[model samples]
Target: MTGTPDAPVADVRPVVRRHHGDEFIDDYEWLRDVEDPDVLALLEAENGYTEARTAHLADLRETIFGEIKARTRETDLSVPVRHGDWWYFSRTVEGLSYAIRSRCPATPGDWTPPAVEAGIEAPGEHVLLDSNVLAEGHEFFALGAFSLTDDDTLLAYSTDLTGDERYTIRFKDLRTGEELADEIPGTSGGATWSAGGTHVFYSTVDDAWRPHRVWRHRLGTPVADDVLVHEETDERFFTGIGRTQSEKFLVIGASSKITSESRLLPADDPEGEFRVVLPRSTGVEYSVEHAVVGGDDVLLLLHNDGAPDFELVAVDLEPVLTSPLASARDGRVVVAADPGMRLEDVDVFARHLFVSYRRAALTRLGVLDIEATGFGPMREVPFEEELFSCGLGANAEWDQPLIRIGVGSFVTPSSVLDLDPDTFETHLRKQAEVLGGYDPADYVQHRTWATAEDGTLVPVSVVARADTPQDGTAPALLYGYGAYEISIDPGMSVARLSLLDRGFVFAVAHVRGGGEMGRAWYDDGKMAQKRNSFTDFVAAAHHLVAEGWTSHERLVAEGGSAGGLLMGAVANLAPDAFRGVLAAVPFVDALTTILDPSMPLTVIEWDEWGDPLHDADVYAYMKSYSPYENVQERPYPAILAVTSLQDTRVSVVEPAKWVARIRATTTGDAPILLKTEMHAGHGGVSGRYDSWRERAFELAWIIDTAAGAPASTS
Candidate 1:
């Protein structure tokens, strides 16, 4: 901490990659071979150097971590969700790093959940899985598939101890409290139990880490005896298996970025042959949900066949079973597509239907009563907050008259409630306990628009302390993720309060690549329009400064994964627009990663990003904006790149190579630091405390950098 520490110098072995009649030289490509001893040594050295550089901010990190912990209720229980004869819930004890899954008996006529509180259990509570116990002796732990049989007597759960997505499935007899001998390994972290409780359906990943095969495992059979029920031959499509809410049909679905296909088999006949609900069509994506409309069984389809924003249609189940090539478009139109609304999902219960969609740049939910004729009028759920996130919760029972909904905003704590089908009245279940005299009134959230260079207005959600002055003096953080049609909705975070309390304005830029507005927004930001995502982020930053929210010196940019690519591009395009950049598990070397078909997710990503390997224009376009390739000899902002060595999504070598090139090429005095979690995956360090500490470290760096103080010097 006394003097500036020398940055770790990467050994460069230039490798020339020729694609589409173009040759590009890449240094540090050898780092991609993570098994190489030299690569591991380099990563270790980088971590050591980063630790030395940020040594002075250790106390600040602790203070922020303490603030996060103090605000969050350490011991709490989630609202129990009633499935069948039991109300299932999870509990976290004080100082515990994991949650304990437990359930209690449910009364036949009583729809009300038992009054369960933290550090307490309901009557006849039976523990199903305690992740803390299973996670012992591991640096990382994640609970994957937690499913119960229709009879509620058998349980199938999966666990990942190394932070990787692959899980090992296990079974238990809830009635006898005995752990069964059945265990399935190397699965894709999901499992669906057969209605009769005799078999479980799960998916396994291929060498590329894609869930490509669906397997059915009998409870008493060996792992090797599991049947490969379905295999997705296309590399672009991933397969998933699950049961309908009615528990009447088991569904195996396969989908790519733009197209999807589903096959259904009756749950009563686990050994029966699966029939196609709809054939896969090019550029058409649809999902099927089994529903009983007026006592007649039907398949409700949410599809984007000709509708850009998607629409809802209902087809008789018998017709889909009889005709394999039946198109959802030929069925009865339940809800016509609206250009402004992007239909996401539909869940049907015995007497009602829940539809989740995004309209006016916000997620909304609507409920419709299932009348004998057809369906009742749609009743949209109302919320007072102008900017908030709301979605469906655990509504496992088809006959359950209540629907659970999770709602929250940047200033509001997360609240879970149950909506009654009879009157659309919502009953409060539980709101997150934020200790230390926290008040939502103390903070304010604003929805503003930033005009991009093309005159397109991009939405930005800003949250700050109510008393904070907006005179370009307060340090601000601009966050963005503009890829994969993922929406960065407004959700409250306890850790984020540390920044707001410290006079930092947090703004999320809803760029084009995201599905914040609609499907058109995402389409305009991906593939050929990918550059729009980065430019929109830069525009948002300029708007914040112009609007007197924060100055360039007091502003910091943050993003992860694909958003990390945005950070890198903006750094090159508008280096003076921000004070610092934090890229976590970034995809900086986009051209390199996507050009290689052998890379994990490379082929699958072609739908989002054009296949540069096969197309000349795509290669040229990606090369033009590839962050690693575009590094120039110019002043740059302070940068902190975080990655996980075990991450199968974005390889650790990307950020490693990016940091190496930036440090070598930049003329700026700012430090470019790299931190790699050796024992974790893309999620970084697992466990609540460790995750908090990791966040604390990043927040401290952001605070220091925004103050124009370099935490590290190189």
Candidate 2:
């Protein structure tokens, strides 16, 4: 043995990829020969993931079993303690399924999920919302809405939670509690009545997830009206512009973008051909927003003029509806958020036009309560965070006015409140609970800025116990969401209370590509700028260490799906930054997954992460960080990667291959385990108890690894 003071000689066993050092090429060729990656090798890998996940679950199950007992302590907890991809399942009481509880939080008193004797299986004894759950146990939730008629005589509803975003409308008579076939396409939403419920108008989506023509349901027929009100496809404008929550205005873009003529049609003329609205300019890009007013008042349409810019312009329906439809380009100003960042949507209710920026970010909720000039000074309802989305008028009740506010904070549970606009006071309507005696005050909240590699500032929110020691080595776990314009905000969770009680510093990294700072922030951090997001997360980890928030040896990082990819990539980029990494249903093999169209969510996300195969630029950039293909025989954090076998979204094979590769390639003995569920979809678990058991398993891993035990003995 060479007596080298610097290097302590030790027998090193390489991991992850040593065996397949040269076999990958030949195996890969065979895979290409059949053009089917569902090979025997892959199958074996899948089994590996199952075994690892099973053992890990067993570990977690053991640790959390005692913790799962219902706490008799009256500890009031607020917001979510942990974060994960989830679903809305039924909680039954006695034998009745009372209300629909989403994986989302309850808005205080207004939407408290009914108490259920069935525990999490079915819930009951309160107001019920007829929304679709993940019934088939898939990754998708169906589209449905519940509305009570003015007289409460009829309960109008639609029941298509998944097949199409379009709903199928039906009515139930309260008197008999029977179904009434108020047959409607259920696609064109907002089934409002015409004065005396003569007809109900609605909109629905087509096969491609695009909004189709508007349809009206007459009081008599079991079928929708033969005549279409408006076919979004024929509007001489693209229909899949945006969602109801985010899209604001539609601008007939440049000729190159549209390729055809642009048009505007009157609402009354269902059979009318498209009326040219503006000349199609080659390569033009614009957006439009329309607000429909009641009865005699004309509809207000807003258009953005400058390229990548926004200018509020209005079109009066009274004049445009009568005269061949006026060009949408012809309008007056209402409001504008920016020119570069596209405006997402506008909500117009009695005397208020709430404008939203970046779909819904630091939402201004600018209420232009003006008939003419000079709307009131914009009321800045602060908290104004990116992780949470705030909306108005979820319910029309006077007691919870100030406009009904629906708010969700990262780590905080979702809640809806009634606010008196005049008083700006918030009154709780409904809220979500895990039924445990835990108080939010038991945790501390703090915000700090971390400097990225390029010196850019990233904000982080940390929550921990009040008496947390500044010992710099607490088992701190940091989470992040840095892609697809999603904000990681407040949410409530039952799984995290135990973690908090044990002194875990739960933090969220509000990195780039999120609407946290408005459009600019998101635009700057996505696609080509995607590297910034990964680095930003790394910086947040470094900041935690540097500030004694959590040190390098004790810091753990966790992320799911896209965030999981973030955690995986950052782990590869900086192995020493964390002690353990938990990636749930992560897109670790980004490039390969995106290149395949068969994957669930890929086809729908081409716009977000550009198609890789056809575009070499996207391929190269994605390859720059995809964790799976980039595996190296280097040291890595003890990793607990999870995925579901039945997951129709992110295929289970992803984690399978990733774990094997990492296990074989990495040098250190630190365990890199995969947990795959055999009978679940993207969520991995069916019931609350099952989910708690899985969560407890993860916490157990954290406890064992962070506390210095065999990483994965089982």
> Which residue pairs show backbone clashes in model 1?
none
TM-score of 1: 0.98
lDDT tens digits, residue span 290-324, model 2: 45444334444334444243445556644543454
Please report, as a residue range, the 10-residue window in candidate 1 with the lowest summed lDDT: 705-714
TM values, all candidates:
0.98, 0.70
> Over the stretch 1-714, how does candidate 1's per-residue lDDT look in tens digits?
358889999987999988878888998899999999999999999999999999988988998888888888888888888888899999988899999999999999788889987887778999889999999999889999998888889988999888778999999899998999998999999989887899999999988888999999988989999999999989999999988878899999999999999999989889889999889988999998888987899888999988999999888798667667557789788778999899999988998888999998899998888888777777888888899899999988888877889999999998999987677689998888789998999999999999999999999999998998889998899999999899999998998887888888999999999999899999999999999999999999999998888999999999999999999999999999999999999999999999887788888999999999889999899998989999999999999999999999999999999999999999989989999999999888888999999999999999899984332211
lDDT of 2: 0.56
Q: Which stretches of candidate 1 lie over 4 Å from their true place?
A: 708-714
Listed per model in order, the count of residue pairs whose N, CA or C atoms clash below 3 Å is: 0, 83
